[model samples]
Target chain A: EAGVAQSPRYKIIEKRQSVAFWCNPISGHATLYWYQQILGQGPKLLIQFQNNGVVDDSQLPKDRFSAERLKGVDSTLKIQPAKLEDSAVYLCASSTGQVQETQYFGPGTRLLVL
Target chain B: AQSVTQPDIHITVSEGASLELRCNYSYGATPYLFWYVQSPGQGLQLLLKYFSGDTLVQGIKGFEAEFKRSQSSFNLRKPSVHWSDAAEYFCAVGGKTGANNLFFGTGTRLTVIP
Candidate 1:
């Protein structure tokens, strides 16, 4: 079966610029997530969506970051006025909604802010 | 708050040798644990996970992990390592709460020598 898919495997932008990342989850998957993985660190959960509704986004930077899963099959994460600290790999994952189900991940978009 | 800790930033092991990586977590209730492997430029793949019942869990690619409630640790192990096993390993924890969000560790990089 095909795994989660993401667009623009790599991106580069200047500080204060805006950037967006897209994710297409596995077929029939009910849950989707966005994570930020800094170099030499693990992926940090940025937001989660169950179908078209958000499940959790407490860690998301409300001032600069936003994400949406309008139709619930695909999602997009956006960062406006990017900062140097925002230079990290953004990973997308999907699961079947069970607590024990394994989450499938995408190659991720490596964002480099200058 | 839930958190995961991988004490070793990097480990190098000779092929055919045994391998072990340490992980610890802080949570008040029973936690869902997972081990994921990420090759360079690739997405994270699930190695194994532990929900409850058996403390020892077997995973793909001859990997296994044991959860110790007393020590609050979940360490990954392999009886014999292979060159292809070289990758970045991450440990993550999720609570039993309604949300399925995960908290990940900094990660451990594994290098296998021939």
Candidate 2:
């Protein structure tokens, strides 16, 4: 089976610029997630979606970050007015509905804000 | 609120040595725990997880984790470390409700000296 897929494995943008990343999850997964991993740190959940509806986004920077999974199969995370602190790897993952199911992750998009 | 803690930031050991990585979690209810490994230039891969029932869980790549409810810990271990095992490891706990969001620790970087 194919794993989660993400685009633009690497990205670089100037501070205050805008950037967007995309993810296509496993074919039948019902849950999707976005996470940020700063250098030398574990991934932090930014948002979660269950079938196109947001399940949690408490950690997302609503002021500058936005994400959507319109059709439930694909997602897009956007960051506007990016800051140097936003430089990190953005990872996308998907899982089946089973509460204990393991999550499958994508290669991630590495963003470097200069 | 739920959180995870990985006490060790980095560890180095000779190849073929036994390896242990510590993880601690804080949550009001029993947590669903997981250990994920990320190799350089790759996505996070599920090493193991503990939901309920058995405290010991086995996973791919000869990895295992033991969940200790009394200590609120889920530690990963391997009988013999391989050079390929050198990577970043993350400990995570999933919330009990509301989409089961995962809270992750800062991560541990392991180095296998050949």
* Model number with the top DockQ: 1
DockQ for all models: 0.68, 0.66
Worst 10 residues of 2 chain A by lDDT: A95-104
Q: Runs in model 2 with CA error above 4 Å?
A: none
Fnat: each model in turn = 0.76, 0.76
Residue B97's lDDT within candidate 2 is: 64
- Tens digit of per-residue lDDT, candidate 2, span A1-114: 899999989999999999999999999999999999999888888999999999889999999999999999999999998999999999999998676778889999999999
Steric clash pairs (candidate 2): none
TM-score of each model, paired residue for residue: 0.97, 0.96
Instruction: State the lDDT of candidate 2 residue by residue for B11-67, as single tens digits.
Output: 999999999999999989878888999999999998888778999999999999999
TM-score of chain B of each: 0.96, 0.96
